[model samples]
Target: MKKIRIQCALLTALSFLMGLSQFIIVGILNNLSNSFHTSIDHVGVLVTLFAIVYAIMTPIINLSVGHAPLYKVLIILFSIFAIGNMLTAVANNFNILLLSRLLTALASGPSMSIAITLAAAITPPQKRSWIVSWVFSGFSIASVFGVPIGTWISDNLNWRFLFWIIFILSIILIAILYRLLPHNLRQKKGHGFLRQLAIFKNTHIILGILIPIFNFSAVYIVYTYLKPLLINKLGFSTNNVITILFLYGLCGLISNQISGHINNRKWTKTLVSFLSVQAGSLFILFLTSNFKWLSLIAILFMALTMSVQNSPVELYYMEIAEQKYPQSLVLASSFDSIFSNVGVAIGSAAGGYTVNTLGLGYLGLIGGIFSVLAISVLLILNKVYFQ
Candidate 1:
């Protein structure tokens, strides 16, 4: 009825907010560093810390809170997110800001996975992918609009106001969610946390976890340091950099939607093809950085390939989990989040080290290597599992 429709809208909105919180940092990095009287390198730690907390806390939170009533947990987590965003807005020092970022990240762990689970719970199995895709589209939209708008705000107004905006959005989402979502959507009896954890023993589950790590390590190696590459290597102005990012986001949005449709037809081959193109795109980017237009085109290609790869990998994990214990699918999603965030942390650290020790030009080279390695892993997995 109207209730279900409202629930879906609220959940999708919350997903968008979660994604905006995660990526808005990228757009405001310069402003934050200047405000805190720190270097951009130091501000980079906020990204690392947020990824690390999300990696560590996702499974722990899922296990502890999975059996709770979904609506109650959603409200509590959204409220915590609001508090975190508000704290970040008012923080006067770097330490306080870092702490606030971690707090916001903690809320993110449960919010996304729980939202996915709720969507799945409401939708029929046959239409689950469509529903999940609609919800997850929030992430693509965040990268497209949220990051650019945040950057504009930080440039035109105060950076703190960006967090204030997020806080207001979180508060609004809390109300919508409370009104829309079912109050008592909990299993009467379920497998205990320990039992759910046991599902990790499956080989497919372990492979699924590692695939995200490998793929995202490649992604973050380039993306985390992209701004500097555009400025220092390509000699682009600030305005150009933001505009190019907006284009990259637009390409990514289209590619993600296309990939979702492709997944229904040829999941394994689509993954392999996208990863291969991604590796090739990174290589081209590294080699072509001196050419402004060519480098921008390379970025577009990278975004397209990476977006095409995302949904298939996510769908692959969900499909594999379906053959096993269905309830543990939520844990599988949690593992996906953990490994992907861990990859972000690893890739960012590696890229940072390479940039400091070697040079910025080496970032795309390292990223290409990681992408190739990920492809190799997937090829092996495909042969073993699909064959």
Candidate 2:
């Protein structure tokens, strides 16, 4: 158990770097704009580009490398990741910086999918979800700690320095992974890339992927626009809002930790309850928009339920792949990462439309609708499949 925990911890650190690399851009957009002599709006494209590339590249890379030993594939991907960061730090122009980001995005997706696969490979069946939850926490931890620290570094030092830090850390992780992962780990028999695509035809696989899409879309609908809502509607001062955002992130971290212990036998009820609470809290935020403290509590409650579905849903995909589609394990593991980006896009667009059409106060109402939709999907999945 101790050894399993250590391996998961290391993989969590790998996830932290990947998450930090992807999200830290939001905090340093101004720095990037200033350094590259471009508009902040233009620099914002970097975020969109990274997401698109990551979503498109993950399964492709997984398919390409499915036959390779997991350890070697991880090392190779991390090495490319290190190079991407290095390129980001040294880029002299906006185009070069964009290129660097593309390079990093290409590596980031596959690294995470493979890391989850490696975690499952190393751990026992009973503990796979626990280990996978730890892996997911890496991104939560990054949002909670790493992005803020990177923002601080950008404020005090230079944005380039932050990538340098990532580069150095990636190098360290590569060395650790090379030494830590077992070389003799069995590789599942490879299916042709076209053959693996057949998994998507399975109703269970498609619905399993949609759960994240709807749930994440629900969370991001309000979350993506939270700072604006806090300032424009909730009447928080800018400085206090930063603290509140940090507190909200801590709630997310706690959410992930709590999710790790959820048992599979009880997952259907647990997932439904969590999503129900999430929907209710969003509605509470809607009702309490005029009441400052109550609105704040509702927002935190939403955060608390935000990640409850992640571990169980991901564990479901991993288990399904292991039992029914072992050859597509890496491809299956990549689904959450890929679709979650799609959800972000959908939610952000929906939130923007709502804000333009209705107002900030209605963001919660819109988000709650999506949460309810997620619940509907879960019910369908349960009745048709789990039962």
- The best candidate by lDDT is 2
**Candidate 1: residue 97 lDDT (0-100):** 97
- TM-score, each model? 0.94, 0.89
Model 1, global lDDT = 0.78
Writing each residue's lDDT as its tens digit, candidate 2 over 1-387 gives 787678889999999999888877765765676787875546656766677788889889888875678889889988999999999999998899999999999999889988888898889887887888899889888878877677667767788998999999999888988887777764577768887777788898888788878887788778766766786689987566556666777888888887888866658678889889999999998888988789899999998988887777777887788787888888888888887766766776677677778987888898899899889888888887878
Q: Which stretches of candidate 1 lie over 4 Å from their true place?
A: 1-6, 187-191
lDDT of 1 at 330: 69
CA deviation > 4 Å runs, candidate 2? 28-45, 90-97, 231-235, 286-292, 352-360
State the local distance difference test value for candidate 2.
Answer: 0.82
CA lDDT of each candidate?
Answer: 0.78, 0.82
